[model samples]
Target: MLHIWGRLSSINVRKVVWAAQEVGVAFERTDAGASFGVVNTPQYLQLNPNAMVPVLQDGALTLWESNTIVRYLCARYAPGRLYPEPLAERFNTERWMDWQQTALNPAGRHAFLQLIRTPVELRQPELIRQSNDETEHLLAILDAQLGQHAFVAGAQFSMADIPVACELHRWFGLPQARLPHRHIERWYQTLRERQASQGVLDLVLS
Candidate 1:
């Protein structure tokens, strides 16, 4: 059986679980990392030397990095659909996935850390403000792109959407004022309505 090791509260872990659901795979998820505490164990360290929350085990294969795991699930199971078989379309999907990891996630991480994880007394306003500023600009760019297409890479939902939407779930769930991005809200609502998004998208951010 496919098994994922990480706490559900983690956005990265949520991506893998949601992808497994999207590809119609039966899998088990074990909580590890943060307060759950198994991530530092010798065995867990062997699986992911980075000591990150998300680690995927499928028979002999062990995978780290949430986006790579999502790509693997789609490529291994869903193929031309979620995996996007066409060369141009596949690269387009790959582009957005990398952007989410390198751009969007970094822009918003500090804000999420301050608002969601850190205590109010200890939260730094400047860090939150700066992170939010960068994230909103990126969100506007994403909004403009979504205005032209139904999904991030194209019209059909693909593996690309999983990581981006999970990041959105984190940013949007933050308790603060956000500028209106109508297209993002519209596309996100559509993603939330998908059956596979039930557990992943609906969870409260942590």
Candidate 2:
């Protein structure tokens, strides 16, 4: 059986879990990181030297990095569908997935940290504003992209949608004012309707 290590509260872990669900994989998940505290253990270290959450172990192959884990699960279990079969299509999927990790997620992280994870008394307004500004601009770009297609990468839902949806899930949960992003909202509603997103997207932000 595939074994996953991380807490549900983690966005990274949630990505892996959601991908596994999308691919209809049977796996075991252990809670680690933050209050759970297994991430720093020597045993966990062998799986991920970065001492981060969301480590995937499949037989002798161990994987870290949430996006990579998502890609692997879909490519292995749902190829030609969630993983995409054509070379150009696969690269398109990869482009969006990479953008989520390297662009969208980072843009919104500080706001999430300040507004959700950090206590109100300790919050930094400037940092939150800066983060929000950066994130909003990116969200508009996503909205424009979604307006042209049914999903992030193409007409059907694929691995590309997972991380971007997770990023949106986190961003939308933040306590802040958001201008109505029609395309994003429409697309996100579709994602939420999927059975695979039940536990992963429905949960409240941490």
Candidate 3:
């Protein structure tokens, strides 16, 4: 059986869970980060030196990094379905995933931390403005891409949609201005309707 270690509240872990669901892989999850606290333990550290929330253990293989796990699982279990096959197509899909990690996540982090994690008394309004502005700009890029395709990769729901949608969910879930990005909202509504994203992507940001 495939085992994943991470707390359910984590967006990184949610990415893995959403991927597994899309690929239809049978996976077991163990809570192991934040308040759960198993990640920093000696045993967990041995499995993943980064002490990350999500660590995948499958037979003799141990893997960390949520994005890599999502890719690995989709490749192994879903292949042409979730994981695209053509060389150009695969790279194109992967680039969006990379963008989510590099561009989207970083911009959204401060806003998320300020709005949700930090108490109102301690929150920095300036930092939140900067983050929200950056995030909204990055999302406009996504909106343009989405306007061209139904999913991240053309019309199909591929591996790229998983991480990107997770990040978008974080940004959109917050109490904020109503974004005029029609394409993103449309795509997000489509994602929310899916069983794969139901529990993971639909959760309250924590």
Candidate 4:
């Protein structure tokens, strides 16, 4: 049996859940992180020293890091579907997943923190603006790519689409003026139609 630990609101956790659903993994999830804090517990620490959410326990083995967990789940279970083959395709998938963690997520965090998590009086306008601009610029790059390919990595919905789409869901959920991004809008609409993305991507932003 597979066990996943994390609150559903977490984007990282959402990535694992979405992938698990996609691959038809029978798993149980325990809410942790944010208000429901199990992260610092001794047992939890044994699973993930970083005290992060979405720790995966597979029998004797425990794994953390959302993207790696996604890769592992897909590779172990749905190799030909979610986990792609071919050298070029594999690296293309890996590249976009890395880009989401390094570029898009950070750029979008400010707006999420201020608009959703932080109180109005505590929000930082300049920081929000700067991050929003960066997020738009980065997403514009994604939009350009989506204009060519149906999905992030290519025509098929691979592991690459999971993380970045989850991040994009967050960006779209924020209440603000958005730069018109037709490709992103179209891609995200298709993502919403997927059974796996039903609860994961369509949920209200945290």
Candidate 5:
């Protein structure tokens, strides 16, 4: 059995859980990180020196990094469905997965931390504005891509969609500036309908 360590509320952890569900993988999840507090334990640190949530243990294989875990799960279990069969198609999907970590996540983190995590009196208005602006720009890019295709990589939903979809919940849930991307909104609606997403991603932002 695969063992996952992370708190359910964590976005990184949620990505792994969502991916596991997408591939119909049966696994055990142990609460850790944030309020749950197992991430800092000596045992947990040995598994992931970075002390991050979502360390996956599958028999002899131990994996860190949430996106890497997603890829591994799909590759080992779901294969052609979640990982994609063709080399070109897999890379195309992989690009967006990397893009989430490189681009969307940084911007989303800034905005989410400013608006949700930080106290209003202590919040940095200038930084908040900059973060919001950058997120909007990134979402606009996604809006354009979503317009051309049904999912991020194309019509079929793959592991690539999991990370960004978690981020999208934050973007749409927060009481911030309204986005003008009809296609992206439509895509989000579709994700909302998923049984796994409904249980995992459908929650009030913390």
Candidate 6:
């Protein structure tokens, strides 16, 4: 059986867990990050030098990095389903994943930290405002893409949706100024209906 290390509340862990559910893989999870504390231990560090929340252990293979784990699971298990079959299609899916890492995540992290992680007394109003503005700017790009396609990769849902969808949960849950993208909201509503998405990505941001 596959062994996963991470706390259930972690978004990175949620990505891997969501992918596992989508691919129908049997796996066991052990809480390890934040309050769980297994991540800093010597044994866990040997498996993942970064001491990240999510580490995948299957047979002799060990993998870290949430997106990499998601890709590996999808390719090895569901191939051509969650993982795109064609080279061009696969790269296209990868593009959105990259976008999430480079663009959406930074914005989402800022907003999440300011809104949820930081207490009201200690929170910086300027940072919160900036984060909210940045989030809106990043979301506008997603809105445009979603307007044309039902999913990130055109019609069918793919591994591409996992990271972005997780971010979307935070974006929607936060008490922001306003969102101009109706299409993004509509797309998010669609994701909310998925069992795996609900089980993993749909959680209070912290």
lDDT of 6 by residue, 51-161 (tens): 887999988999999889989999999898889889999999999998887888887687788777788898888887888889789888888999999998789999999
The global C-alpha lDDT for each of the candidates, from Candidate 1 onward, is 0.95, 0.94, 0.89, 0.93, 0.87, 0.86
**Cα RMSD (angstroms) for every candidate in the order listed:** 0.7, 0.7, 0.9, 0.8, 1.1, 1.2
RMSD from true fold, candidate 5: 1.1
Cα displacement (Å) at residue 108, model 2: 0.5
Candidate 4, position 149, lDDT: 94
What does candidate 6 score on TM?
0.95
For each candidate in turn, the TM-score is: 0.98, 0.98, 0.97, 0.98, 0.96, 0.95
Candidate 3 C-alpha lDDT tens digits along 45-110: 999999888999989999998899999998999999888889999999999999999899999899
Model 4's lDDT to the true fold?
A: 0.93
State the lDDT of candidate 5 residue by residue for 1-206, as single tens digits: 88999987788888898888877878899999888887888999999999998999999989999999999999999899889989999999999999999999898777788888988898888887888888889999998999999999998888888998988887777667775889998998898898867667787877
Alpha-carbon error at 161 in model 3, in Å? Answer: 0.2
Better of 3 and 6 by TM-score: 3
Tens-place lDDT digits, model 1, residues 1-206? 89999999999999999999999999999999989999888999999988897999999999999999999999998999999998999999999999999999999999999999899999999999999999988998999999999999989999999999999999889999999999999999999999999999999987
Off by over 4 Å in 2: none
Per-residue alpha-carbon lDDT of candidate 4 for residues 21-123, written as tens digits (9 for 90 to 100): 9999899999999999999999999889999898999888899999999999999999878888788888899999999999999999989999999988999
* Pairs clashing within candidate 5: none
How much is 95 displaced in model 6, in angstroms? 1.0
lDDT of 2 by residue, 1-206 (tens): 99999999999999999999999989999999999998888999988999998999999999999999999999999999999889999999999999999999899989999999899999999999999899989988999999999999989999999999999999889889987899999999999999999999998987
Q: Which pairs clash in the backbone of model 1? A: none
lDDT, residue 35, candidate 5: 85
